[model samples]
Target: MSPLHLLQFFLCSVCIHMFSIFTYLVYYYDLFTSSHEAQEKYDFIIVGSGTAGSLIADRLLKETNYTFIVLEAGGKGHPFHDIPAFGPLLHRSVFDWHYETVPQENACFAMENSKCKQTQGKILGGSSKLNNMIHVRGNVSHYVDWFHGKYTKEYIEEHFNYIESNIYPLRNIQYDSQLSDAVLDAAKQLGFNELNHQNSLGFQKSLLTQNQGKRWTTSDNFDTSKYVLTNALVEKLIIKNNKCLGVQINYPKKVKLFAEKAVIISAGTFNSPKLLQLSGIGPAELLKSLNISVVKELPVGKNLQDHVGTGLDLVLFDTSQSVGMFDMMNFFNLYKYFVNGVGPLTTPGCEVVGFVSTKNETIPNIQFMVLPVGITADRGSHLRKSLGIADFVWDNYFSKLFEKYTTTFFPLILHPKSIGEVKIKSQDPNLPPLIDPKYLSHPEDLKTLVDGIKMLTKLLETDAMKTIGAHLNKNHFPGCEEYDLFSDLYLECYVKHLTLSSYHPIGTCSMGTDASQSVVDLTFAVFGIDNLYVVDGSVLPTLPSGNINAAIAMMANIFIENTINQFNLKTNQHMCSRNISFEELFLNVCPVR
Candidate 1:
């Protein structure tokens, strides 16, 4: 090679190697890590704008005396977030993280329904903006388990109750839709009970995450006066003096801000754990491979237990009766929903939720969600395979498939003992996390689905489904049809072909009294860190009993409340000595008409 060409090649190699080394060090260990050049001040700064972060920000706003900063990696959610029918439409849009999991062996080498890529929200509402709004509260036993999980912690039950006050309100509607009623009818025909349990307390009826048929998000719950900002993007957490001061966030404008107070990481299950490892907080061994220095060896991205789900898809031959996105009637109804808050547009896909036991038990090990429409065509996944999906919009593959004639019900493996982890694909935060959901990695997880599938097949056999001519998509792999029953070979192949994430990833940065299984205390504080806290799905010690959106919001709200309370008490006590007037608050209030 010529000398000049050689020099160019060497420099490029050096750049790649340097970046690789920097990422590895950050991933494995971190103690010297903090915000870069952050000296600005505020009361609280939260990272991520998803379900949990938004709730935390909004609830903290109840304390108007405090100055808060919200750092979102994705942009703001749209009015579409209020429309439940548009849930699938939101996937691969700007609001979604659009992540794909690392390829699995049991599942197809290529993307199948079970192993299809999934999405998380990047907008203000987080995943709640993108998720189906089925409101099934977990069984009460789960919370009792949550409370009992950290019995040694200080006042855990108090945290749970405080979280409740911020989540479920008394005033919601009970309108019966064609979707939910059908499932309840089917379940009852088979002698399964359907009750009301959307409050994170019980699970008998399909609860609504809607406020009067409009979607309920963190923005709806809080921001009583302020307009929730649009298109905010966060780049990095700003740390200083061995404490999390705030974040160094860059917007589309490219202007960087240094938030004061504490930078709370609530980036949800996928992003939160990934961000922590990116910011240099993960396993020592993995971090060493990436060349990132160990700032805190507190296990930033281990113990990843994701709630995996699978489904039986039935397609009606007659497009005449089959509901799809292209149906002009749907468009008008959707528009009407935005205006009057009535019509099919108000319901997100999977409007019905059920908790069931594969083995006979009062407690549920699986969660079933029913949708009226078929899945949609994902331009993102199409482009990713035939073309290419941009990293930002490529995560959710299954939802992006085919236009809806879906009439599908998905069930989550609720109590799986398996776990997974998040690693850096590269040092670039712009690139997605190297996600390893390790879905259905455990043997019992497959059995849970086997039971769930048998249950769903029965539901489809009902007059509601069969009258509609429900038929399975039996042509995925080579031998999928032969094992339609519960043979080990069939179960493995079927699971590989049909297994997919419910998109509710939890426990990456788990919370527990046992350091062996957890990454934090019950207080949501990262273990071994003085000021760092995790306020998203990543901190849950185990998978929650029901839909993760509301539960995540509850966890985030409680974590923020505790932190702000402590911060406020400290400031209030400090103010008392200085004799500063509360009049500053009155002056700061936005003038009302």
Candidate 2:
């Protein structure tokens, strides 16, 4: 056997043993398999072992009497998964669902070629497995709106706190590269206020999920066996009389399994909606187009939302350490990072994050990512320049390698006015979802990113920025680069092609008691379905101004609690009288079977 295959096998074996019995809470439910059908039907069968599913099983497994099965769509972390510097290693690999967007009209005719691929991870880590790794909690208003705006729940505030306790936050994140400081000073000069946290405008720094240089994804935190499923694809929901008894999991090598208890759909926004539709749930009109049976008619694939960032590259002097682009020493530094958990390779070129409001007073809607170096291009798919623009955006401003170049990505986050959708192309699970993010379809969204770019440029003029030799791209704007570079039209065009999804997709299976727009209730159950729930970003009522992986972990806890309470429906009288705090509810219960 090839050495690479042998190494892969060894890694898989080690990972399995490390995670299995100690943390994994999987329960098999195939009618064709073990007659050990004698085991309790289980309390729940969690599907799509990604962000939400991982957290859900971690909490549920605390109870010994109840059984939980977490079915993953793919296996655990990749070789580079644990390495912070190798963040791009997981992109478009076996883990990503390289979905494409339907041509958007509002965007420049130029965007169709420059921006097409919409990426989301398909592995145990989910998108958290293959993202830029910049972490933010967003503004406080993002959550306030969710509690007061839609779900309108009284206990949501407390639930939010519970979410914070479930995981360890990656802190003490800093960069040894001067490029990191240059990006921040540039933004500050442009008039944008730097925040300590990624989302809050009051100076919350961009807090990452990295712990001492290693990625802090579930595998690094939770019991890997409990959440990370290897090679488990959920074909469809096994519904009996409108209730989800289990899932139809295609394990390939093993016979199919039938989960007895309830089925929770955490297969991300796209897959969860498609699975629901495949099992006869979603918009009747769209499902009809697919010629599939409609079980419960609702907007399963509607109201998609994502934060889009527009890339504006500036060619600078090569002195800037723009990642592995220069110094061979940088690669050696990365080697130190993965092996010894220190040095340049561990930092994802993003050190200082900002949370600032634009000229508008309505709300802070843009999230700017400060990169230490210039980005090459979208790493997902190959460039299709023949369709439109340049083969590669040349560094018009830079003359040599020693000239450090700084790239600023202005992310127009969660524009309330803009919305997108997901659709299934066929019955096949292998087909990527028809993800049309309908970005900038809303004029206001364009304005947000435009103002953000304007703010970014404005910050560069500040006194602190002069030390870094920062300059606006007078020639970078598509139509109006020369017109002050921050003119309305220049900002508009930049916002259009420059703004792309942060890979944080949610709101499709929004959570609420209201059925008109919501796909799941507060307990995460499908409104009309008897025993099913969605526990991923698909269920988020609104996008928090920050990173979502943290929230996904919290929501899993809330959903598990709700499911347990519902399962023991008769105990409301006794349990309610005892008034056990939500925090202590699971302490008395044994580990889940």
Candidate 3:
């Protein structure tokens, strides 16, 4: 290396270290400065100030006169959370819930101890804080199926519009590199057209949950900071006579908080069900086994689904065609990012995304997400550890590709057939739930993934890819050497060994009209349990065709409007002679006394 290049590296190192110190200072500052005073009661008590919880609370505070409190298990946000490129680094950090699945029967073969590491944000924004920020509205048909056609396309689109306008508008990245262009061209070569946000198929630059090169999380929509109590974990619901009351929070000291109207659980997929189970609202047998009095017998943690994908890295012969650490950390890129808020650092790694169908061309089954930087680009540093890649696999397979110009393509199974469940182990709210995603357990799911791999291989054979000199990294995966390289058996083995979650887990606390098959009703209220609702990804009855975040926001928005209208209707129905709110009306004029 030249002296000037060495000097540039040193300067970049200093800037990163200084920024790290600043972020730490900011974290500590918020930790000490924030207030955590709990009121005796509220009109509504929201547990888990994640994506849905934050949006619901904010909307309630802004649109209605209802009194509510948001309880978040995690602490305040950091500066690092704002940077798009710094997303992967946030995994397994203080912000993440840091969950790991139990050793699986049919999948996660090559992960540490055969356990797949699940990353969920424990921070205010929840998983949105740790995701790639890909903003896919998903296919309209999926929404139709979710609401069972009761909600029209226009109604759903209106809600989506409301959310997009109020929370975070969808936007594409400012710049596209040569690799991005190549990916797009290759998709065109395969006869794929450009797809808009509403459409499900074709190639397009991914819409992101960002503004001006910064990540826009659900927490950013919250203006009612005083009502939000961070670091306050909801141990269980304070239920009485099968009617929901409030919550019992544990922030080192047990504090009982009453909710006059309802208690909403928006604690993502895993925690929402886990919280329900802990409060004796899950399967009767599980509650009986745990010796807890059952509040309601419902399948609180079944029907778990996620968009699982396996990555294939392509090593480029020409180094300039792909991005590496040096390209991202240089003085020029830093200047462009910090001062102008535009550069590679603005990307969450995925630059181009395409949707393709393995079985049906019209309905896409596989989503192709391309990242400019390779997983091994960081040289066994953060990315490998974040994914929980085994040390042996890294040393043997990925270590050779360090600093090599590469692009990683992930072909995600858009609609997985395999269903899993989340269950409570010992009725402990602090202990992580037993998450069994059961990825690829269904024969169809494995077949779909294999077909996705085949599609990706086909994309590589396009003339566009050849121009960039992109070739599949042929190094045999440690455990998949028994089969011939590039063969179907070898690819399947590679997929099983190197399965990576798209981090979009949903449907644990599913919603439907039938109580036998669902936890929450169409209104998001828990079946057989009044005044208790779930409004997170947990309530999704099935996985959406694309990224799940946009659909979640739309669902929560509908819930908020419906709930507000319901609350208002109740207030009007119970009107008394004295002019007062619903809570006061209930307390003062009971039985016309």
Candidate 4:
């Protein structure tokens, strides 16, 4: 053979080999795939591959013989979503739904036109991918009150324990910041006891939902091998005779999926209610207004509740050394994280958390979060802009405090007397929902927050805080400039102007025994509907004291157990007598009483 011919042959061989290797890599990661086409029918159709939906799919696939599919509105999460510190950056990315509240009369004064930002994760892991990774189950008393004797404390604890397998507490690090130490000492000086573990009262280091230095989202807990259709937006439910059969999805091309056994709506709080209303399962008046034929006249979008909180930024006199947002973005720090899984890149930002009771000693009404580094206007602009904060808030409140060594204290109101609602503006499922949190609507809600702020102020005055030279930023707020700085009235005005949502929206499709009061029954089945259930944050009858991720997981576990037990009973009875129907058995097994 000629030398030229031999060179060409060798080059062609190398190109073919490289192409084959690239193809293998693409298939290995399950990347570059089109929407998964559904079978003619599945045993279960779960909408939204979120915190609850993903876990539900895992349980059903692993513990039963049922065939199921998860329909997700967004694609697989971004690469940074698995990192602990990139949580804030995930907001407004393709991963977030980026829903905003309607203009409010009572709160969100600092945001754009009194509208608070309502962020929900649109990716496979849902909001768990975007949350701060604080793994808190909230106080047990709050759960007892919400359940109202329906669920015993023992039952709740059991479910929590089962879900705890996925969680790993934040481990102690060798490098300690002066800011963190000062905050802990201040908590002690204020007569707060250190909590030994999560779900307990008093102040302590936060227990994160992370393994090592990486985030452990719901996506990590579940089996990803199960079939899931990403970027497939579910438009409406296919319902007939008060029974949910399947879902209609819009994946740039319309497709309908049928479920033979049941349909579960685990589309988080905002989208779940919206989907129900679109399917003519909401309030009769709302459906009629939208020209939708009402299938069930139930309040599907009422009783929306969320945790609201206000924060205070404190400037430290010493600027010799401190961590800031830029520090995490440093190439060296990123290298450290990628190589050794340590450094600022592993931090969840909010290091310490405290639970305090403002009204009753038995139940915690407020949760305190301490961040070692202060958030300045530049950082706020980067983060809050994506969160939908207005230019007015950035200029008036945040911009003045740029480039300062500081620490921030967030006093979160656990339970608010005020309630909100979610409503659909148009019949189009593509448009966002009208979210109205109506934060601080009740007079007492604001009063309770003020009391909590006072407690924070006292903590700042402690000797430990003084040692770190911590002092409140006295920047003049636009609406509260008339009040004297550091006074009670001034602080009250500050809180009213600067309050923000803790991002824990719940109870929109609340669960209760009565059909009139809630959208779902205690068993998580939608009221007045058959073969339909909701097992997401929307069905939480009340807001927990802390982050609601753990609670959502626990509810999914309980639902799985209840479903399996019911299925087993029906199967056993059918073996004994062929005369018994599944519907009759379900009704007999599950009664409101």
TM-score winner: 3
Off by over 4 Å in 4: 1-32, 166-176, 196-200, 312-317, 377-381, 578-593
lDDT of 4: 0.77
Please list the C-alpha lDDT of all candidates, in the order they appear. Answer: 0.60, 0.61, 0.82, 0.77
All candidates: TM-score: 0.77, 0.80, 0.92, 0.89
Candidate 1 Cα errors over 4 Å, as ranges:
1-39, 108-115, 147-179, 197-205, 222-232, 252-260, 315-335, 376-406, 460-488, 514-517, 572-593
**Which pairs clash in the backbone of model 3?**
none
Candidate 3 on 163-275: residue-level lDDT in tens?
A: 88888856787765788888889999998888885566799887888877888877787564777888888999878888888889886589999999899999999999999
**Best-performing candidate as measured by lDDT:** 3
Best of the two (1, 4) by lDDT: 4
**lDDT, candidate 4, residue 214?**
81
Error of 3 at 273 (Å): 0.5
Ranked by TM-score, the better of candidates 2 and 4 is 4
Better of 1 and 3 by TM-score: 3
